[model samples]
Target chain A: METGTAAHDDAAREPVWTGLPPGLLKMRRLLLVVWLGLLTVVLGALLNLFAGPAWAAFALLPLALIVWGWVLLGRNWRSWRYAERADDLLISRGVLWHHETIVPYGRMQLVEVTSGPVERHFGLASVQLHTAAAATDATIPGLVPAEAERLRDRLTELGEARSAGL
Target chain B: MTTPGAEKDVPEAAEVVREQVPVVERRLHPVTPLRRAWAPVAVIIGWAVHDPNQAQEQLTRLTTITLLIGLAVFVPAAGLYGFLTWWFTHFSVTDTELRIRTGLLFRRTAHIRLERIQAVDVTQPLLARVAGVAKLKLDVVGTDKKDELAFLGEGEARALRAELLARAAGFAPETVHDVGEAPSQQLLHVPAGVLAVSLVLTGATWGSLAAALVVPPLLWLATHSVWTVLATALPLLGAAGASSVGRFVGEYDWTLGESPDGLRIDHGLLDRTHETVPPGRVQTVRIVEPLLWRRRGWVRVELDVAGSSNSVLVPVAPREIAESVVARVLPGVTVPPLPALSRPPRRAHWCVPLWWRGYGLAVTDTVFAARHGLLRRSLALVPHAKVQSVRLKQGPWERFWRLAEVHVDTGANGTVTARLRDAEEAAELLREQAERSRTGRRDARPDRWMA
Candidate 1:
């Protein structure tokens, strides 16, 4: 019974980490393919026309990188997770290297919800939290619009409730 | 923390504002024009210093005539412009704000709210000192730009600064009338000779001196050219010499004193700067001990003050004295010694192998301290209450070694960051630091400090 309670305590120490939705990964992969695919086609045609068809093999490099990046993007998306605790918010991201930023609710100066044209097309928005420190670049991207608004409102409320002097 | 009925009192506050008498607008001291226009006037004079009468070939008649005309037109124009600027600029202080009207054609007005003031600095440049006037610089929160009133009588500036600080602390302007120097006691003072010797012994100066000695010989051996050696040695020697001289002039007769208001720093030889660091505004305190200075048991203390540039608290002092100053600067906070700090595991050294041993972090009850540097050691201490945020970062190599860096950021630009600690410990530090910061902020003094 003591071990069971210890296990529960350990679990409580680690908050529930929420990963980004698969739609963001899909949208990013689509963007990568479109941009790199265009470059590959243009380069392949130019190499085939000017530098001989044998030189066209160089264009396949970008295509290969695209494939590698497609897989990497999914891993990166999976690695992007955030946790909300009683007093602060935690954001952890990156694949090869990791970064974790903890911004206490009281320290938050501004909470903004932003959606670009492309993100709006995908019905996605981002919530950016600004603390007094410029180094605290905590951004939660590619959430559904409704969830984004909810997060922004909730963060604003929490921030106001716990506001502190710099 | 607003009461529900506060909105109903808005009209009453408006009535109070309307009932208050208007403050009389004032202009800067008469010497302002001379102080403002001296730079351009000297520049023009320096440009015209080459006697046209002596240079036969270079100074053709047309060029000489043009030079004379240029000086004749520019000198008076600059002075007139300065006078015009001085005439147009007017300032007045109200109970709620300090307003300044400037610009000749555009007529710009700036209103600085009293509550937003972070610091009031009284500065006397060389020219201003000769003229017996000082400048008042207002460092306000929420903006990096400082609003300054140039060339006021020194006594007037001090009285105005006292009044401003009092008003910012929630006092009415009338209550602070006839304010004299804040009651202060001397905390520490670094002699000029110590400052000069410390500057000479700093790692940068010695490194440059070493480069001058070693590189020229090596270059002479390699190239068999005297000019190459001279070319390399002269600049290095000049740089080392100039840096020492500049630092000596700027930091001469450094003094730190404490008052109920805050810490006051008086320094500089040619330009005497009186900087008042209000209580609780210091974000971080750093103590630096260069390798050579370490032998002499001397260290430099610097402070990251909110809404102002980083300032040297003391140029050079003994280790104990520096520690005491730091303690005074940040009262009730403790800093752990290097050995008492938490260091990373052996494997974490793979990230920064040569400098790995230099990394250490300590969290006291109220302060978070980070120690780093090998040759020139530095210890940065930040009160937990001053922490704006905390971050943990890892690079690819650090990932391979499972090492991470934790950064505790304050509102100021400087950060107390510990590099190459165990990843798990760094994460734990981040979480615990946030909690400490929350509690620290909760316990910190309220915004209206004097009240």
Candidate 2:
């Protein structure tokens, strides 16, 4: 029950209404689990070749972490929520220990849209908002390219108008 | 946060006309050519050093041929290239903006509005100092990018800085330069003993880590493990000490004084650094009292300005001096009133025994202040208008105990704010802060730049 840095909320603290693309969760899980599976294979081979079955026990730690993470990633994905308010944007994420980041529309200096090869393959992109204060800066991941562009333009327009008031 | 030059009555077309009229257009100093040719000179030296035998043997021929070739090819080419770069790099100050144009081919220009200049940094690096030039970096309020004018004459840099700051404060620029009088006060100085102690503390941390990692092998191989350990540790400790001493020397002779434009600081042992925190740009201020200096009542005052870091207002000083600095730099904002803070919940005793009792929060009409720490007490002052966001948090145990904490942010990077305890209270506090932040920014007076 680690307490994360989160902003004000009612006692119930209902989940935010917005979410990432539905396909994003499955993609993230596959990417992580595939890598972990490969590591398990490599570790098992090395341990058996060098130190035999007794030393092979060392492989359990990473294997346990991978298994735990693969199962909990669904919760982590569900945790990510972003809400666009009239004056600011709220980004809340983290599974066991929840964290929330709030970035004001007025404080936004630059809104960038970026997509890596993997994300592009999945037809997704991320929008990053840069601010003078690093901590308040926020990024929204797993939006479609068109949606990312729309958000960037909309945010940039709002930023210019409200900047004088930040 | 008010937009500069965008206040009620100014027309957009008037600004366009103002942009066409330049107040001062000056090329960088003559030494800029030589400075720009550093890469070529370094390459030439590397060629000479690569093979001393061949270089020295044919010294006369090499000298004549290279000199002729250098005169014919490299000198003219490097000189022309450097000269072109220098010619292209010109800065102009307009009534409402500062325009810097550079680049030969791409032809890029950066125009910073007069009121948007958040912080002005005057830095004299080694080469620039030797060449009698300094660099000026203008940090804008909302943008992370800084507009810089490199290699202005030192006097010119100071005059420009003073003028820019004065202009931002809505004063006659000429008056700031002509006043010739030194500023009002000098607050604190890092004594030699403090500097030595700071060095030792830094050295001990770095030195011990290095010794721990490096000594084991030496101990295993050497006949006398203790001597080997000592031998390894001495050099590591000396290196760390020397490095810290060098940094202290670079930032030495630090002096802060009151000026019409803002609270000005003139310091830096080797290369001078002149920084001004204009009237309203100061975002957050923190007062810290280290444990070692507890009995002596020494403390440090650090602050953050929008769009800039390097906010060390005071390295170390007496508590009185720290308070005085806070008074001068951050006017109007005051210490937190203790009455606002209720007793900490019973659960806080274990994790934050020292801090629990001293922790406090108070909101005045214009500002909110948070106080924490026991022996090393720290008080953070942030105005309602400056608040960027607010947070309420509860650790697992805190949740079990129905305790919560509230965090307020002001867009000042690396600022620290304690969360409030008691869930309902924390929620109420956050909501109140958010509303205050909105109304506060709406009705707040414009900053120097925006005014």
Taken in order, the candidates have interface RMSDs of 1.0, 2.6
**Could you give candidate 1's per-residue lDDT for residues B1-451 as a string of tens digits?**
1122333447666445545556779998888887667767676456666554445444565576798898799889889988998898888887768888888788878898876666678999897888889998887665434258987998889888887777777653445664456787999887887887888788787777778778888999999999888989899888777677767888888889998678888888999999887777888899888888988899988888767763788989999888888888888875577788877788966677778888788889989999998888899999999898898999898888888899898887667898888888888888888879987886676666777
Cα lDDT of all candidates, in order? 0.82, 0.70
Model 1, position B85: C-alpha lDDT score: 85
Off by over 4 Å in 1: A1-12, B1-19, B38-70, B141-146, B209-238
User: Model 2 chain B, poorest ten-residue lDDT window?
Assistant: B1-10
Report candidate 1's interface RMSD in Å: 1.0
Q: What tens digits encode model 2's per-residue C-alpha lDDT throughout A48-156?
A: 8999988878777677877788778878778777876655677767654555666667767688999999988888899998765566647789898988898898889
> What TM-score, computed on C-alpha atoms, does each candidate reach?
0.87, 0.70
